[model samples]
Target: MGTGLRDRRHGRKDGGGADGRNDGSIDARDLLTDEELGLIRMEEIPGKLEEIKRALEEKVGLGVSFDLVFRVMEFGTKRTAFFYANGFAKDTVLTDIIVRLTHLDREQLVPDTLSSLLNKYVSHIQVETEDDFDKAVQFALMGSTVLFVENSGAALVIDSKSFPVRSIEEPDLERVVRGSRDGFVETLMTNVTLVRRRIRDPRLKLEIMRVGKRTKTDVCIGYISDIADPRLVESLRDKISKVNIDGIPLGDKQLEEAIISKGWNPYPSVRYSERPDVVSSHMLEGHVIVFADTSPSVMILPTTFFHLVQHVEEYRQAPFVGSYLRWVRFLGIMTSLFLLPLWFLLVQNPELKPAGLEFLGPQKQGELPLLIQFLLVEVGVDLMRMAAVHTPSPLSIAMGLVAAILVGDIAVKTGLFINEVIMYMAIAAVGMFATPSYELGLANRLVRMALLILVAAFKIPGLVLGVTVWLVALSVTRSYNTPYMWPFIPFHAKALFSILVRRPILANKFRPSITNPIDKTRQPVE
Candidate 1:
């Protein structure tokens, strides 16, 4: 029998309180450094139960006062205990389980009590025996119910986990005109199921692992076993396993940082998508996907510069229309990144201006230096964006009106900003909004700000230097050994051409070589 019943039978002789803490007090320092407890074997179930109960009390507060529930039940003469977190485990399911267990006949509760309960009494579809007491505790904390029977030396884990998630709806960030309105929710199981529903192939595999020592957040790696490179999968799995953190409260962003250690690099190495179709499309192309619990977004690995610029809307339309949309988006991205700096450079060196493009220069220079005015406008645009996010939807139009009419008109009239500055800035802001990847857009904004500073200090040379530095950074940066620039820096003509012009789905018969997919051919050439 476990020490729980032994201790109870012996009348609490260990000087511990009803909550299981020794001397009715535990040091906060001991609870915080509980990682030292490590893995507990099945043989140590009795002592382990006491230690876990004490730890739960010290760390999660008194069990009775907290959401954690530890209930003791009986199956004929055998003693049993149930452990679960309140909100995570479904109340009706738990009630049903208890009712069924209580009705089990004495003959049903054989000598192999744990096996008997698992094979017959437990009505849940998902039930498994966990030999490791530490893992059992972790599962119970994560929302599953852990059933411990006297002298069983193992616990039965019931997957009755339920997360408080909103209804699946269209993702605002990746909305499209003609596509599925379904989007990933905070629930990990739902997100994985969504992807699985789209890709029914047996090769599609999702490997689930726990991250964070304290949080034990569930992280999953999804990829097609045949299409995705074996080495790439191992490399990502290794990187994720090596992440030694107390908790990943921020989810995917924190996991990205841990996996890809890009020190001081502003460029986003991985692409994120909330749309299941988008994730499914990427997976079909041999890319690996990382799904973090509590996050709607999933990280697409080994993303290239071109990947960030593409959108699902392009594929939803006709081939020619898709190509046109792709080109327009590309132009907008380019304008967002370089239009202001190029304009500033032209104004700085009027001699370099072409014959017909002289009007590109501001008619009246503002009181402040051009650089300062540009910087101010950039800050103002960011401020307005932040304000709009916080402002209520009904009042957003009024906020926009105040910013566009009041702020811009006053700044120009007061000589704080030139008319040309406002025009170019507005255009740039629109281009930024047109960008598909929010991370990529923000990175471009940062790079643009840096280029503006460089252009203000030195005319033509600074612009050249800035462009060179940006290209060099891209060329050097790699996401899991795959080139960040891809096709462009390495100069693969076919791939580069495909990026410039959206290729028909039938024409894209081969997966990109960058991922080194095992199955190179996506489909039969015919």
Candidate 2:
């Protein structure tokens, strides 16, 4: 909460001002609370070993003990202690560190000597001193080992944070036939390393920071230093750093909401990918990536509507095949959005129907109005979807059977829904499932229902007005200042073509201009 670093001088009371001056009087408006202030102050180590022990016992619940590992080591006449979380710190690494520390000779062990021990003993690659006890405690909680010497004011922090994580496997959501099976895991370091493995260039930077006051959750911002726009990176960093929250338990989803701030907007502003290759591709195109700890999915920032609709499978196929696949997907997405509504419109105005298309309307109208039937079926479909999600894997097939046979047959036979409504709704649901982005699919579903209601109530004019409003909303929507409906709304021929048809890798010689990448040329001409 404090804006700047805490002064490390001895007995400088008045909570050393943010400007590093000993103001001698604590300001009432300082952001840090009294507890945080007390914990951060380490001008002097507690006079007795019992005092330090008592503080640790009270604050971190060391006495009551769960995962906290506390050990005191004696080297000749001097005594030192090490603290770390059991599950977070690797046993082998912690044992190696402790074994190395125990070998320290009496001559090397001087009273109140922190720097000498750090240089001579600690063999770990990541070791640093923390003047603040609060920060040291935080590091310990995050799985880093904290070393406390008998009389030293500073605590040595060893980075040994390893979390329980699943092995990298192909992401279920973004599966590809010919791509790498290695996907991101829940571990932050592992996820970052996955992206690093793909983009080996030194210019690719992954800046790490912590959010959440209590959780201190790690968040990484990745970008290509040469290609990515500096302003965009800095702006994203600024927005993330300013997030004031207790925790982000849902990880990327929560962070997305905090940053984009698009209230009540159904469309997703950022694209999410669990596949390292996909994230790598986006970063090369100058998009900034956000990786949150405990989340397998990383967010690709400043995304357009086209980005959400795209799938990794397209690139895996031949250019012509990919383009064909892309167009098919686009058709599916459009059908998901408009099929039901258009059918309703045609049914409402049978005069507009073509000569052979009279079979589109229901044979026998149900007891409920056509609009009511459509709404009820929509709600029923959503309920079935939710039920499927909650159902156990073993029972899922049985659940599907119940939904397909029992629900549909009973509804149609009882005159609650017509056969035409069931058939069309099922087709629409198939299209929705075909959509690449689940969030976008849901948004489309909502839009479809809205369009259906409008057409049912106010007829043809309502359908036109609703579509116009939808387009206007998308046109006005911005993702980190990048136009949401780029290429389509702004009329970029090349980009729009790229969206409509998957171009060969050799043909994509330039990065997207919308990102304002510093190096525009992805590849030089032969």
Candidate 3:
């Protein structure tokens, strides 16, 4: 029982909430402070129903928090109390369970307490016994209906948690012309089901780990058991278990930071896919999928640069069509990363322009410096992108129209920017959008900006140094100790070939050895 709970915050540090001093926007009231999550007694429930209710109320803020509820009812001579969060278990579901409990009397529950209630009284699917009082409270807070019996040693946790979620729809970012419209939602179980339905393998395993002590967010590590390397699975499990954060407010985004250290690095170590089909495909290739509760996207483990640039849409088309699409996409990604800087370099040293193409640099020098003009346009485009995202859907199209037709045209005529600058920037912008992965696109944008700055400073040598540094950084970087550049640096000839060319489904027989999967062959060669 949690009756003898005391305030243990006296010796505790002042700033448990991530140093608590930096952000002025953070309201002191909202955070689950140490004083708030006081230490509770983990002893067995030795006391009767009334005493348990008092202890539970003090511990769980049963009446204090309007969303938390505790119902006391007696079936014949046996006293029972239902503890659950109001937000999770609906009144209708509770009422139905209550009707069932009414039939269970003291006689049926006398000899065996916890077992009798779980077996006979509760007819629900997810009922289980928990002895620790704190754990029972934790489960209730996480949306399970906990039952406390008179002087019972353990509590019956009925998992009837129905999270508030939206209808399954295609993800805005990962949309495709010819593919499944359904996408993963914020609800963990729903997302799990989506992936499980696709795999349909008995070997498919989902190991659940509770992260963030205060938040207690459910993080599921999904992988195919027999196929996935035990070392890889354990490695992922080990990293997630070591996370000692208080809460993950931003869901998977924050959890990712815990697993992978990104100090000013824009490139994502793991690929995130909202589509279950995309995730299932990865699992088949022996990659682990990390699903954090309240997050729509799931992280695909140990990804490469190539993995981040590709999408499921490529597979939807014919082999030839897919190959062509992939090549064009690769070209766009290259253009996004190099086009602006190369053009700027050419402009700076007009002598570098080839004999055939004298029009490589801007025709007319604008009032602003060429570099200034390029930077201004880049910042302006970024602002437009941000504005489009924040604006209402109906207004977004109109805003885009105004920016394209009115703003770009006006800037060129006013000599604020050259026509060539506007043209080249627009091409670069198109290239950025052509990238399938949003994170990768943003990363490429940052790399582009860095390249521009380097080019302005040291001319040809700066560009060379910048390129060298970028390649070396990526080459040294690892995703779960797996090569980020993979195939290219490690030089897997077959794998590199597969990446360059989208081989037909039947043509590929072996699973990617990069993940070190236990089962290598996908299909036996004829």
Q: Each prediction's Cα lDDT score?
A: 0.81, 0.81, 0.80
Please give the lDDT score at residue 296 for candidate 2.
91
Judge candidate 1 at residue 320 and give its lDDT: 92
**Per-residue lDDT over 370-440 for candidate 3, one digit per residue giving the tens place of the 0 to 100 score:** 88887898899999999998999899889988998799898788888899888889899999999999999
Clashing pairs in 3: none
Best model number under TM-score: 2
Our tally of clashes for model 2 stands at 0
Off by over 4 Å in 2: 1-43, 111-113
Report the lDDT tens digits of candidate 1 across residue range 136-229. 7767777788888767777888888788999999999899999899999998878988998898875666665667877878787788878988
- The regions of model 3 sitting more than 4 angstroms off are 1-41, 90-92, 104-106, 109-114, 524-526
Clash count of each predicted structure: 0, 0, 0
TM-score of 3: 0.89
Error of 2 at 395 (Å): 0.8
